[model samples]
Target: MPARFMQMQEVADELSVSVSQVYHMVRSGELPAIKVGGRGQWRIERARLEDYIERKYTETADWVRENPLIGREDEIDPSD
Candidate 1:
């Protein structure tokens, strides 16, 4: 069975981002997480992580719709 909760590192790995980025998300309340154990380690619920991913997908879709590339694709800098 899959884990119901995941460590910050696991969350970062799942999101393909750095652990520090995950920490920042949690600290900024952009991602839902909880402090656990005496050492105050952070753990995010699996459901919450899934929800966050879904929300990001929706946000990205909206952004794409609002910011159409159209003829401006050629104007984009390849090296930025």
Candidate 2:
């Protein structure tokens, strides 16, 4: 059985990102989370995390569609 909710560190580990990044997402409203317990620790629902991942995939697909690299690959600067 899986947990219904996950701590900030767990979410970060699942997403392969830093814990601070998860905090920023929650703070900026990019990722939905809830504060619980006396210490006010943040917890993200498993469903919500899955939704965020799906949304990101959609957003990335849209961005790729809008910015096709077909003939403009040379325009990108590798040094940057």
Model 2 lDDT tens row, 1-80: 89999999999999989999999999999999999999999999999999999999999999989988998887999985
Off by over 4 Å in 1: 75-80
Off by over 4 Å in 2: 72-80
- Give one digit per residue, the lDDT tens place, for model 1 in 2-35: 9999999999899989999999999999999999
Alpha carbon lDDT at 3, candidate 1:
94
Candidate 1 global Cα RMSD: 2.3
RMSD of each: 2.3, 2.8
Candidate 1 accuracy as TM-score: 0.89
Clashes of 1: 0
Which numbered prediction scores highest in lDDT against the true structure? 2
Candidates in order, TM-scores: namely 0.89, 0.88
Against the reference, the lDDT scores of all candidates come to: 0.95, 0.96
User: What's the TM for model 2?
Assistant: 0.88
